[model samples]
Target: MVERYAVPDHQWDMIADIVSPPQKMGRPRRDDRLMLNGIFWILCSGAQWRDLPERFGSWKTVYQRFRQWRDDGTFEQVLSRLHLRLRQDGLMDLDTWM
Candidate 1:
């Protein structure tokens, strides 16, 4: 029996709700959520993508997804939206002299 890890429902829902629907493509598709999460883990942890754990799935898949998101502007959009929300919520401090 393959064990499936549970991504926090709120976090998963936030990502699903914020991200644009995967674009329609002619080719058969591969799972994107695993790849996106793997890439995000690497970025958040400041670790090498190749060092991503097997539990996260293939490093190549994550790298490919990262590149695709970059090319498609998805990553930028997500970051921009997050920044905007943080600013609106007063969670982002812009004070330079601390």
Candidate 2:
């Protein structure tokens, strides 16, 4: 079953390219949407990484990806881009969010 906090396809499409850029070499990466859903589950549910659902794959993998993204400011970039997209679409009000 899909997780409750899984990002919908439309939303995922907005940030997919930014979140998981085309890899240049080596083995392919895990599914970003799944990992993102797992990350969202952790953040929204306030659960420990160890408690991550199995559908999201190994907790360690998700944790590691989370760390990599965190250290690289991926989250910030995603949020910025999302904000821009939403505002341009008239779906978000910057003042209200702030």
The candidate scoring highest on TM-score is 2
Model 2, TM vs. native? 0.88
Cα-based TM-score, every candidate? 0.63, 0.88
Per residue, candidate 1 scores C-alpha lDDT tens digits across 48-83 of 988998977788877887888899888777777767
In candidate 1, position 10 carries an lDDT of 60
**Alpha-carbon RMSD, each predicted model:** 4.7, 1.7
Tens-digit lDDT track for model 2 on 5-93? 98887888889898989999999999987888899999999999999989899999999999999999999999899889899999998
For candidate 1, the per-residue lDDT at 95 reads: 79
Task: Kindly report which residue pairs in candidate 1 clash with one another.
Answer: none
Candidate 2, residue 3: CA error in Å? 3.5
lDDT, candidate 1, residue 88?
Answer: 89
